[model samples]
Target: MNVDGALAPAVESILRTARERTPGEDAERISVDARSFSDALADAEENGRVPLIAEVKPTSPTTNGERTDDPVELAETMVENGATALSVLTEPEHFGGSTENLRRIREAVDVPVLRKDFIVREEQLDAVAADLVLLIVRFVDDLEGLLSAAEERGFQVLVEVHDEEELREALDAGATIIGVNNRDLARLEVDLGTFESVAPVVPEDTTLVAESGITTTADVERMCDAGADALLVGSAIMDGDVGENTRRLVNA
Candidate 1:
């Protein structure tokens, strides 16, 4: 079966599983703080280096299997190398990740953690304990309501766009952090030029992040040349020596 085609159902199942795992009282009392993810990135940028958001992803829809199941160790290695933040993939079925992994990774590292998933509903956001939230432009037709609700809940939104129209909608929705994902959601293909197409349209002050298909120091340099303030890398670090590769990417 094509896993990408079943992504929506798989995500729904994961959310239901997360809700089932949480106790009634714990779920009711759980609250995210007022601090946003942007605060962490801003602080890092002020120190004169690009923020590196390293990911602890066990698997992906494209990969179709686990790259690594040890979340805590991976989180530690990322931090030890020079990652400014952590991105924990919480989508269970498609990504081979879970909320338990996210909570464990957060406890394992001190850096801010972003919940990287196809965030489509508010209740889904509450299911995972994340310092930052992601919003995919291709996933939703209405942007205004979603952006407003996310901000109201004290979550920093990383609005992800693959095309110019999506970029425009993200800015209109008041997205402070704009991520240009090179991976096309419709075809599940990656094109590095996607960043080149969208980066210029983003405001100078907005934190620009290049996501997907980045693997080497050369890729990092290319992204930096294209005006990216941060980069989200997963497979390369997960499959290689995490600490060594992370240091090369961050210090590049």
Candidate 2:
């Protein structure tokens, strides 16, 4: 596969990280007890409320360092404040995240943890024991194969997309859970309309997650109104009181 699609610099950095890992280390095996991430998300809403999958990214290419000094503490606070699941950034370089963060956060919370990283190889999948994993459609050459591999590794897939074509591609690749990233990979620009525009085309059976640019209660409501089952928020929640910000979104 040519993998000729134009990748954003942040994603390119992730691919570089994957390529740099030692051979067997990339494929190093792990055995974790099965936790149904699909069900965890599906059951998150018990009283007609949208679930909030709060994130623990230390930083991003756009945002250099994290506000939270203790990621595990922040993760615990989120769950205690009604977070349905957790999204932990495991990308070390640009994001300032590490597998150590995911491991600690996962142990602190019973809710499913999403291993959010630029996953390009099967070995990357084996490195984390999180219950869920992210798979960006534009970032990989074989979407179906990676989705299947994640499932085989006992993790639910959060297949991300930015447009109609990518949505269709994800569906065709058997993506049961789809997240519409508001930020365009090419320009690294955000517009929540990305979710509104592509949502109607999504099947009712597939779980829909809204990622990025969701900062306020209104933002949460907007995403819910646009048919999102959940929201994957990081920066906004991490910027202030984790509990308060999380509860605000949860109440939204």
Task: Quote each prediction's TM-score.
Answer: 0.85, 0.92
Note the residue pairs that clash in candidate 1.
Answer: none
Residue-by-residue lDDT tens digits, candidate 2, 19-119: 67532444566556756666666677755545989998777876655664798998999998888899998877778788889999988889889988888
In model 2, the worst 10-residue window by lDDT is: 21-30
lDDT tens digits, residue span 173-222, model 1: 78888999998665667899999989988889898999999988888889
The per-residue C-alpha lDDT of model 1 at residue 73 equals 90
Alpha-carbon lDDT of model 1: 0.77
lDDT of 2 at 119: 83
**Leading candidate by lDDT:** 2
Taken over the whole model, the C-alpha lDDT of each candidate is: 0.77, 0.84
